[model samples]
Target: MRRIGLCISLLVTVFVMSACESEDEAQTFADRDQETVKHTTVKPMSNKNKQDFQTLPNDMQLAIVFSSMIRVSEAFDYGIGNPEYFVRSSMTEGEADIAKENLESIQFENKQLKKQNNEAVALLQKTHNQEMSHNEMQQLKENRTAFFEVTESMIKLISQVTPKNAKKTRQQLDQLKKQYTQYSAESVKIMNSIVKKQGADKASFERHLETMLQKQPGQPMLSELY
Candidate 1:
């Protein structure tokens, strides 16, 4: 009887130790799993959608091209002659080269028209007259008209480009379009104010333009410019 009792005590001690070791292992595994959950839960930043000029979505691509042309016109109107600003700010190096190549491919007639517009702006600046010559004024009107037309095109493009699976993209595009339209109207107000003051100083005008551009639909993409 004494021998049996001793054997029973030994067995109970071994069983208790084994049970404790199993509990410890399970707790360690739970802790490791909690760490893994924390690591996997962290989110990454969204990627930028690089514009491919060649393979542009038909409706969307034309909108971008026209928008770029309008920007070039605006730059000319405002005495911002450097294409580098548009090239560097609007696109990556690859896109810039693509755009430059495309622009170069235009026929002589279209190139002449672009040059004529530039000359018209220069003539107006030299004369310092709001009342420009017939040809110069006509070019100015064309530039402004193109800018407005492209703005409409861009709104349409945004509508088409919003992904079917992405409610957020649709919502974002809608809000962007509304803000851009409002700011487009306000740009005229600011331009008028500048004209009233006979055009603000370069620094002042730039600041105003920056503020205005910031309000536009696609300006967030310009963050990559910096």
Candidate 2:
């Protein structure tokens, strides 16, 4: 009986030590997994937020500037483009406030869009580490690469972007602005011609305006107003 009791005590001691070793090994594995996960987080676009515009390529930097300008243009259009009533070409305080609020919101959206684009690029760079929506993600990567590689395509894209995109990711803003200026000049010439030709047919102005819209769709609202 005494021998049986001693054997029971030894068995219990062995079981407890075995259990503790197993627990320690499991904890070690869990710690290793945590360390592996820490390496997979998204890195900042520029040195952990020390990002300077100068760090990017000159063309890329210009593109970003152009995008920002486009957003401002959109805000301007949204705020003052149309109003229910105009009191001598000025808006009511409430209307003005709404416009200002909208402009600010749009600008913030532009910043977020830019950040998303950058994040997408970063994700692509880390393709092996994560899964992505292959179709949209790959297409965006390819399209941006293709566009940036071609001077003409870049110019055309920059020229035609909605005010919002232009506000965030555009370059060659001056060139785009210059193109608008040139279009304005040409439109003036066409309008003068239309005025001369409109002496007989009142609808000729509409036809000419439509013709301009067909040629320059980017400035449709402005053309329509003219």
Candidate 3:
């Protein structure tokens, strides 16, 4: 009877150990599955963030290049007269320092974009003349995309206002918004000039530009203005 009792006790211990092992294995597999799902979700999101510059139509690319050029030119012009407004400010000292660093980066990028604007204009002229190569046009599109991306980043930064500087920031942004309206008008004139200069009747370019502008995230749509 004692031997029988010991045998039963051993059997129960073995069963418990086996159950524990099975549960541990199941948990390990569950952790691995979660990791795999996380990786799968993250990879596609990273890829989705990348802009497919090559997929854009050539006409649309030209309009983007023109739009970027107009914005860059307007920013430069506005900075010349309102140099104080170009300086970024923040509430805390740490944030103020960061703002300074961002402003410096923005200034550098804007200068570079300004330099490229002449090249962009030359490319537009080449495009109008039907002399631009596929490679050259593609390069223009990529450059303009980069230009707009930088400008968009700067604009977003400026649009944000802390409680300390809300009024000042709004005042600055208001001035910039007026300038943006001027930019749209100037873009229209520039596009008309380009078409007239090329003796081309493809008003489709204007339509394309309008569509692209309407898709911009924050700014008021040109269509709404009319």
Candidate 4:
């Protein structure tokens, strides 16, 4: 009977040890998982104060504006092409309804911008070793104007319809709007002079601009929000 009691005690002791081990293992795994999550989590984009584009060099300012225009144009194309998808993914029904109300107008704006983008691309491609004609330069000015005007209109409409709960999106839109204001005014005067050169000056500028365009990287600042 003493041997039997000893055996039972041993078994009880082993059982308690096993339970304790299992709990310790579970806790170790839980801690590791918490550490992994802490390391892997993605933080939200911060709104850092950026230097005004107007303060940048003329070439740099134009590069940014041109790159932003291209990125935003691509975004507009995606939204226009997949209206249902965009609405479903990014907006509530109420917001979708508001977007739909001005759908035609926005579509028209997109169409105009696309036309100008095509023109600019073609002009740049053929002007590799030559100067742009006065007419071509004029067209570029018009295209730049259209880009800012259309983008402003689009931003305002999106801002108006964006849900208040979309804090990140609203912040992004505001930042973009602020950028638009910076690049659209005095920067225009600089861009005009840059594009309005003649003879050798025009050719050099065109080649430089074309090379920049050809190697232009994607602008996530404008693309992510759209």
Candidate 3 overall lDDT versus native: 0.39
Q: Which candidate number has the best lDDT?
A: 3
- State the weakest 10-residue window (summed lDDT) of model 4: 1-10
Q: What is the alpha-carbon lDDT for the whole of candidate 4?
A: 0.37
lDDT of 2: 0.29
Count backbone overlaps in model 2: 10
Predictions: Cα RMSD each: 31.6, 32.4, 25.7, 25.6
lDDT of 4 at 66: 43
Q: Which ten residues in a row have the lowest lDDT in candidate 3?
A: 1-10
**What is the C-alpha local distance difference test score of each model?**
0.30, 0.29, 0.39, 0.37
Candidate 2, pairs of clashing residues:
62-171, 63-170, 63-171, 67-166, 67-167, 67-168, 67-170, 68-167, 68-168, 71-167
lDDT by residue (1-226, candidate 1, tens digit) is 0000011122222222322222222111111111111111111113564433334322232222223333333322221111111222223445444423322212212333354334333423332333423443444455445544543343333223312323443454344434433333333333333233333243443333334333332232111110
Query: Which portions of model 4 miss their true places by more than 4 Å?
Result: 1-96, 108-112, 124-167, 199-226
Measured against the true structure, the TM-scores of the candidates, in listed sequence, are: 0.23, 0.21, 0.34, 0.30
Query: Per-residue CA lDDT of candidate 4, range 150-185, in tens?
Result: 465644555345554444544554454444433333
Candidate 4 displacement at residue 71 in angstroms: 19
Tell me which residue pairs clash in candidate 3. none
Give the number of the best model, judged by TM-score.
Answer: 3
Arranged by TM-score with the best first, the candidates are: 3, 4, 1, 2
